[model samples]
Target: MALSEQGRHALRHPPRWHWLLLLLILPIVAVSLLFEGWTTHEVDGARTRRACTSPIPRSADNGAPVLRVTGAGAETVQMPLRTAALTFDGGPDPVWTPRILDLLRARHAHATFFLYGTQAARHPDLVRRIHDEGHEIGSYTYTGGDLGSASAVRSQLELSLTQTALAGAASVNTRLLRLPHTTTADTMCGGEWSAARRASDDGYLLVAATARSRKPPLGVVRQYSHSALGYQEATKLLDDPEVGRFTTVTSGLGRPSLTAPASLLQRLQGNALIWTQSLGHRFARSMTWALGIAGGLGILRLVLLACLARVHVRRQRRHRSGAPWLREVNDPVTVLVPAHNEEAGVEATLRSLLASTHRDLQIIVIDDGSTDRTAEIARGVGDPRVTVVQQPNSGKPGALGTGLSYARCDIIVMIDADTVFEPDALHRLIQPLADPTIGAVSGNTKVGNRSRLLGRWQHLEYVLGFNLDRRMFEVLECMPTVPGAIGAFRRDALTAIGGISDDTLAEDTDLTMALWRVGRRVVYEERAVAWTEVPSTFSQLWRQRYRWCYGTLQSMWKHRHAVFEVGPAGRFGRRGLTYLALFQIVLPLFAPVVDVFALYGVCFGDTGQAVGVWLAFLAVQLVTAAYALRLDHERLRDLWALPLQLFVYRQLLYLVVIQSVVTALLGTRLKWHRMHRSGTANQHLLREPAPQPSGLASK
Candidate 1:
């Protein structure tokens, strides 16, 4: 089962996550079918338009009863107004519209076609044909389509009339108009009614579609153009003279007409159909809940995994005192630092690396199109060990690739310009390269400063969530990410994977997975730690984490099939894939919901249900927090923010997942949302912002 080059290329590329989201897709499609089936049933048996507009002939003696409402002083009273004709609103699509017009043409019909301005204009020949066919042409208003302000509404209607005139409407002065979507009965359109009054002054009459259809005394014929195609057959049946009931408008030139409602099963089926009309809404809601619950489960699983990882790491640390995992070695390492708009941070990063005890390293700072003095500041560091390369802003992947091309050393260490490495971090990171079996080593990243509450929370997160759990993956040789901040890879190992693809947002993660796919082992060095700055503001944090989470998803989605291959290497690959899917993919999606849903429960007065679930979720979070603390030696106080993080921090991850999922689905533009640098180059990273004077809102 070996892959050819072409097959490998195809296999190496990750299918869109939507393919996996097919997990939810089947259920969604099923739900849609149920609703659609119900709609088809109701439309087949439901009432059709009972009335329409035709010339009454001003002098003709008509028997139509015109019930009137009049206001009086002593006997003043309010009464319901009756309507004779039903109106169809919004549309002029060619597909079903022509059929409707043809049906009307066959019957020598004259129902007002309330046409959308754009549609009417686009299909003017059809509008001209509608007029040519002797139908009463009406306006659904231009952007009756747009539910906006009074002025906006007027503008929409006026545009519609103008377009209708342009479309060869027999007369733009036609008084008939139907509001978009909602009826005059809905509250949102009361303002529309005022707009309607202004329209009335122009001789306009507001119309509503009252699903009633019947034959008149003089062989009067009418037809409707429904928004959907499925409704066409049903409307035809409803208007059938043989099996259907006849309906008449009270104001029309006819005796008062009353039609019976359809059968009991039809009513039941009708209610279901109406609800089914909102199938998209229902599916969206269901998916939202599924996403929430899935997120909660993902987080919970991450917690357990992190705890287990920490326990394993401690055991390894105690037993392997020979320091075998940290065996120091000398191999000339070329450190690639991709810089973009990093004038504020690049110098410090170079300064930190130059200060490292690892003397055999050559630092290449690739400035990826910085408008700022990023390149100048990088060279300004004045270290012979540092080399500054300039290029257009081709992005990190391109920058890293450029740096790698120039690299001469056997090992390549990719570091972010924003990160500040400790003196020994570089030395310890490459130590694992001494073992021929180890092709790559990933370093732990610590928050440089955590004075702000947000920073502290992120600090806690790195310790508990990533570093602690990465320990287990390291031992399993299934490590999913060799972070861009500090990852050491054998130059040959990297080149063997055909270098990194700039197309992905998370190139580091992509490279790591690629290495594993080629039977190269990646290990994490807990002792090799770099301190990096994180976003301080809520918006900044959201954007940063969103990119990271989404990018990781993209990478995972890209390399999904590698998990659990059969040959020793393939088996290892499969294990890695399973670990990521379970820990990274499923866990993050599920954990937040455990927190959010529990909160929702409390709001609904389900105290018992809320408390039970809340405690269980909190316990998982605490386990993760405790484990992160053990790895990074941060305080337990930071763990208390976990619940609050759910409300504020984790929701952003969901948004990112949703955004990424949509992008994958629709093939949206994928560009890296760069993280902004905060402090002066000479200054250390800022502490997280202080808790609000009033903490409740921040909480």
Candidate 2:
């Protein structure tokens, strides 16, 4: 019962919306990065400003006069002698802001507070306190980003978001603006001066400090940040006899107050800002948790693969070592090869079966309306034991059901039309059925064509992913899919489960689960190896995997109620289904989100940490894959493709899962995807002679 390669291209070619949705993610991420201040330039030449550096001086010697914009343009306002306006920048800090505010309150003096939109939105209570205490509030821009070097959109957002945050907090918008990094009025040069002019054009009063003097100066705005030095300087100024009065920026100039009632639009904008801020915070926190869970699950899977794989290897060795003494049953086994347009490999498949060491064999090749030489090829095999059955274009499941009806023996072995078994594969495969309790057994299926990179990748997946997982699944007592490539089933068990079911695309997985629900145990036989031709190209691979993934999903859902059942059914349901859901469905879905976050970190956040974490995960995977290859008796050199697979090949698998889920959610029916056969299954066999049978005589 080989996987049909027909209509594979259609299944693999995703809908336009799937690609458009993927393309749309880039722009959304770009916009998010921009808003997060990734695109903003720093204040001090190309370097980001860490904190407020030097305090603004307070004297006429500061060179250029600070411009106070009015309806008539701009005017330089000079303070009256000994009248200094104390100003604080970069706060509403949770700790320092409160200390500065308390200091000003105790001194009975007023100062203007320049607020960053981010800090303000985070602590609106502090913003209200600043306004209620009679301290003037001025915009320092959102995130305190340098507007001069920022993109136009970022610059506008920086200014407008500050206003929105201020409005949301205090129900007021400030007309006074303080350009970050500008100290004394004379410091406004180049980009700073340009930014100031732009601010003035927007009806903002550009405030800067006067030069420092030996004595407290009059009619100057003394700018400071909410820091220890700023607090100390403000305290010293308050005690200076030369500073006759301390007041807000506007009050010092005898102009209107900075605070005003926010308009309807401003209030609405403020509310929206608050909502977005909250949502952003929640999203960030959730992503952090998601990354943590993903890392944890990934590490856990690796550990299981490495540890349980060792156990599986030990168990296999012990079983094989005892096989010589075990009671041998030369049961007349019926091998069913279900075919559909597999003419290229049909001869090799029949020839392999004829060469099997198992005697008293009955081989039936069901050609399900293959519009090729599949039936002719089977009949030409010349083996008297081989029987060719022709039927209409029924699916693999139907063909398998039809073959089972014609089967003459109790022990039935089903092999894909393109699969070539090792000489002893059938013999070892049927050994497990000798145990009356074991109703079915899955054989080791390896990719036969490994000449190309894609083929090599699939080969690694067989050893590292599928084989390692089967080892763990066997130990866990939740063996899910006895692959159709080479699986042996008892006739009674197949009949009990109603033969092969066509209700799901994954007939193999569906039939396996049904057997479990009926209290039949399915096991794995690693010694029984079968070589099956895998899809060579990405398109063919996508189609095969997409159908496989979609079918598995359908099968899981069909048997979902088994989770609530008792005994082995519940055990398989809970353990197998849970593993599938978390690792298969949920993990793949979150993988793209993880990649997006990694990109965000590289572009806007912390690149070092992101790269470090990614490398660590890759290292763990490499180690686990190495162990899996060793367990499967594969070469370590093949592991070079493991890391590369993580980047490209793994993403394809993830997309397959995603598309399968999307299709299932939409209740869309998918046809069986068939791979074009190249008859590569016997290529390896042709190079090696068939091994002679041992212990038992060949009939």
Q: Pick the candidate with the highest TM-score.
A: 2
Report the backbone clash tally of model 1: 34
Residue-by-residue lDDT tens digits, candidate 2, 1-699: 112222222344445576578668756544554454332331223234333233223332244345754343346766777888888988778888899889889989899888888778878899999999999999888877776665567667778888998888888998889888777775655555556667877778888887776246546778888888988988888888878889888888888886798998998889777666655555555776888888989999989878877777677666667872155767999999999998999898888888889978999999999898999989988889999999997889889999999999999999899998888889888887777777799998887787778998999989887878888888888888999999999999999988888878888998899989998888887778888899988999998998799888888888898899888888899999999999999999878877776666665556688788889998999888877666656668888887889889989998888888877775565688788988765675576543332321110
Whole-structure CA lDDT of model 2: 0.79
Residue-by-residue lDDT tens digits, candidate 1, 487-584: 89998998888986764677887788778778888888777878787887778876676567656666766676675454435655677677666655
- For each candidate, what is the lDDT? 0.60, 0.79
Clash count of each predicted structure:
34, 8
In candidate 1, which residue ranges exceed 4 Å CA deviation?
A: 1-303, 318-320, 567-569, 582-600, 603-605, 680-699
RMSD of 1: 14.8
Model 2 pairs in collision: 4-674, 5-674, 5-675, 6-674, 57-210, 79-219, 82-218, 83-218
For each candidate in turn, the TM-score is 0.57, 0.85
- So what's the TM-score on candidate 1? 0.57
In model 1, state the lDDT of residue 115. Answer: 68
